[model samples]
Target: KKKKKKPRGSGGGDPGCPRVSKPSDDLQTSRKSGFFSALPLRASLRGYGFCMAALFLFCFGSLFYQLNGGAPQILQDIRHYLGKKFSLPRALPFPSQVVYNRVGKCGSRTVVILLRLLAEKHQFNLVSSDIHNKTRLTKHEQVDLMKNISKIPQPFLYTRHVHFLNFTRFRINQPVYINIIRDPINRFLSNYFFRRFGDWRGEQNHLIRTPGMKDDERYLDINVCILENYPECSNPRVFYIIPYFCGQHPQCREPGVWALERAKQNVLENYLLVGILEELEDVLLMLERLLPHYFSGVLDIYKSPEYKKVGNLTGTVRKHTPTLEALQVLYHRMRYEYDFYNFIRDQFHLTKKKIGLKSASQPPAYSSAFLRELTLRTPKPLDEDEELESDLEDKWLLWCPS
Candidate 1:
């Protein structure tokens, strides 16, 4: 028999996974607080066998990435280079340092809620800053925050609306990244006219208190604003997907050829999962599979009552005021975003197929029963990490020497 490996930090699992204690299913109390506190002595023959298996799977993810091709230009569209990119066949996890760089108006709140639920359910620490309505965290503040997390006893999930940037500068364990993007057109519309409009609308807000509101007209004022100064409007406010994904830099917002390419490449390298807002169900299912260790029981929570109540408020359109014509005209002014949207849509479909899921672009019809199953609520505060004990055993056994 082989031996076992020690976790680099406390509460760690497997060999190179997160160092925090495995999150118990219920956050109210730890189911196995001392489960991995004692490091198994690997000097024995049996311990060595266990160590080899654990280490192989731990590094298998990197090998898979190298074999699966890389970010390259194709047909002048870099999106094709991201072939089967978002889906991970083998990957490692370091949960405490995981960061969800939430982009604004990208249905990011739903992702945050899901992360919060996972943190609470697993009993992992969640270092969510109460900071709200901001685009980026100050570099010094980010550095200090990461430093503080190292002193804490549990793993953490940092979820907030922040643009992507090099976190290594903060001198921390490089965080595993995950985020979702939206059809730029829809995201633009959502940001353009949702919430705080004519007091929940059938009417319009006369003041147009929105920042960067150049002209406070009664109608689609941004339309006119674009015609007068296209670059100023499109570059700053409307064309945001590239800037958000590309990380914080002046060149990122250049609205040039290199800018788009850099954003695509950054996504390919940094983010483990880059899901689309349109194929949300597939994304959630994908999360459970890819990070099964961390998101084990998350799949069942979708149908629970507390999950639904939390989900519905953010899932559906809270209100709407834009017309089809408004979107059509807006599209004309935002051709770059249109290109970005189409590329990501194709990427999502291709990724689903590579991972053995039905093509998201052409999903089959769901029965009424299945449709209702999606909304039937279950009690809140999700269950324990039942998969941990079994998963640990099953994974090692697969590689045990015969």
Candidate 2:
């Protein structure tokens, strides 16, 4: 058959020879190859879509974060991460030294109670002085006291009924200072009643505390005390709150513009915070925020059932609200105090706002004429002479043990 054509896979070729594919087989092979080849492209397309979606979400999230003022926080966190990752490590000083030259009758005892629990839990030193009688000290005494305070181990909180002690003035490292104050009239009233009847400690406790008190003096009507201008209810006594901030200057004990201004300046410069006792919860919240080392969880402690029971047990024995006329007189007498109180309240609200807490209202911005108005309100012509400390009983000397 001459060189007749043989089948590709069979014939006179070697038995091991490979077969050549037919057109139909080629078509099937091409289809399989095409299907396998399309898999990679399809996978790549899915990956690309996924990346695009992720990018879109990232961009949207960034925009939303920026709108919510979270961009700076993100940037800060990134910077912090980078700094920690790449920078040479350096020890940062923790704020460990704190001073609470606590004002008397300003819920300090309650704070102390909470502090006692916190100190036990947090393992920090809490030095609460038992001495309540002396707030002012001689230069020598101040130096001695500052030395003593500085010698306390680090991470310590020293609290006492004392005026502001300028450690820097004596070349000692100044500790962070915090304080709480009450409405001046309210403070006066509290002190006034506390001296006479004591707290829930019982009347016998009061008798032992004030052995020299005459029945008339002890039972004196509060209205008479304010209206009749009793020495205890007047100037230097009402002048009380400012001196706790105004330092140990003898003049600080007097109620005058100088003392008031000095107290304000000191508060601005030295105090980390000057809270109002009326907003005690807010005060504690701020404390927790500003001094987490010492005051963390303090609010919870204050709200605990055990703490509430203690508070009730230690409440003022007899609190009398003065007659409206007496209250008005007391208010006028405490005008400077009211001014300081208003300032502290405004500052407190501003701080609250900064910390993302709601305030009933923002304080009005003071105008340039504030000084003139302040002077007019003081009315120096009406200011009487503040009596000597010895002339009146010092009700601030009262301290109920916790």
Candidate 3:
């Protein structure tokens, strides 16, 4: 006003006068500045709130589900939480191989250990069920998931407790298929006693019914519950043995019908390399032939401890003879498949004389420690050499049981 103040809303204004503008421009500028100034802070707070809400929901949901006695669901939720925290690569970097292990208390763990060690040494990928696989998924669900996930066509090694039907679909050109079969009588006895009192939890008495149960129920009872409920049995028998050697139990056994048909089909279709756990030295030799680069003498494989362990045998309630007779009866009922296993053994040129193999025909070694170091955790690399020495001592005792 003193020196021609001009219009206050104009671009140029007096120094002491407050600036005024057209209502439209003022509104537009105010809106823009306001938004820009508050945008980052608002976004950050929103993100934090979202995470907190998710965490709260998950914890509340888990507790609610557990309280409802939905054990499977609770287990699944826990797995999901752990999985998200420890996600592995979708595919391993190097080409991986598959191994199908059959049942027996027959050193299957040692084989798994060897394969894991080899995979690590060669920088090849080892696909394990626990790390990341749909093994825990139901059969139908797992098959569908594998089909979709397999389309990526990356070279990765995967191993799991899979059935023959599921395993045969993979186009493994020269994959190694391995299985170890023990004497049917011994195996049956092992199965029977292990189910009775081993650390295995779940329906135990359902193993051998007290008569009047339907035959199919009997089969389901024996085949399904016994194998599924026990961890040791579940791992070797259900996962590897039944699938790789004996196929799923048939609805009816017509003549020429057998338990291992599907496994036979898979073997014919794929380059399967079967290994007898009893003849481990021969198995190692076959591995040398199959995978020369990795198995070559660069590493002394023989230094690997003997599979047998000397330990106390539990569940010896009555005289061994009666138990042996009962096992013998069961063995004969399943002898057809046992004969097939023997044929495979013969084809491999594995001989009992080559390795001091044990059989049902051989008398039981009562003093032998059959349960040696069963609870020992897998030794770390730094402790392996020492563990090996201890195992060697244990093996000496096992060999000279009496």
Candidate 4:
């Protein structure tokens, strides 16, 4: 046989391809040279087993991420590098508990009727309180009412003609709040007439509703009440809409910036969707979008002929528009109410836009003078140095980098 060139270096079998080392060969080399070399092959294999287990865990961990609706790490890394925020996709849970602390004469009766149908069809507990007259509860009453509401079964929607109750203040689990509001002047006019001559039902309904009212009180003229500044038509009473949102605080009843700001803040923090009565259809649409479980088929039910016939019965009879002069006085009285209503309306429109819904009525654009006046009314912040010094306990810095 031709003298076989002694297989090159330590490969010992072939010179043709220059021995291609396998991962097994590398492992063998590592095991033989390192601290492991002194141990048995079985001991070296134990380390190999640990490495294999780690790789297995890493693969399953990636699979687990994908199962819970997360993107792969490589794609997330690419998004990060591209300066895009990566949001992990997750299923949105339906809000089971909801509270519609209905404002008086804001078309809440119409909504409640629709809700009755919804509750039946959708099979959710609809605990609508029968107590319509009592809104502002005493401290003991608030605690009692909240306790009763808490005891109701889960996946329920509770509605009532009550002012906002701060569940958090009482340490109860706060429910998701939803409400409908109307133009301040329009709401006032509706209530003004409704108290005197009920709806399509009859005057008897008004009599039953306000049993203690005097005949003089029942037939009070809208123009006279507004122009003459009657208690029912003046400051605190005309300041109706704010307290419904601003909670049961005594200050909420007083017409001021504090109540207005507090109501606006509560709308942002507590209330889910505050719909306007003029845009009731859009309100239902938003409710369906926001709380699909409770309000899924609400819009369809509202549009039905059967529902329309029932809704017609609730319309305020002898509803008359106030004269321009009387309306001007009423508007001035409800300036703060108008401010809150405008804020809620704008927020509703913005949400509608976000969900690809078009509004038939757009909010009016303000003039430069009006905007300047609003800017002047806004609270001004102190300068940075002044703000820093005002709250600081120490005048001197503890440490500086440079």
Poorest lDDT segment (10 consecutive residues) of candidate 2: 392-401
TM-score-sorted candidate list, best first: 2, 4, 1, 3
- RMSD in order of candidates: 26.7, 12.7, 23.3, 17.1
Candidates in order, TM-scores: namely: 0.56, 0.69, 0.43, 0.69
Ranking by lDDT: 2, 4, 1, 3
Clashes of each: 22, 0, 4, 0
* Candidate 4 lDDT over residue span 186-298, tens digit each: 89888988988899977699888778889988888888887776777776677788999998897887788999999999999998899898888889888876776567767
lDDT of 1 by residue, 113-231 (tens): 77666765444555554443454445664565557545544355566555676767665666778888876666765665553342332333424434334344324455453444433
Candidate 1 deviant stretches above 4 angstroms: 1-96, 136-154, 169-172, 198-233, 315-329, 362-402
List the global CA lDDT of all models: 0.56, 0.77, 0.43, 0.76
Candidate 3 runs further than 4 Å off: 1-96, 101-104, 130-139, 148-156, 166-176, 195-243, 246-256, 293-324, 350-402
Model 2, range 173-198, lDDT digits (tens) per residue? 99989999987777888888888898
Error of 3 at 26 (Å): 99
Off by over 4 Å in 2: 1-93, 359-402
Winner of 1 and 3 under lDDT: 1
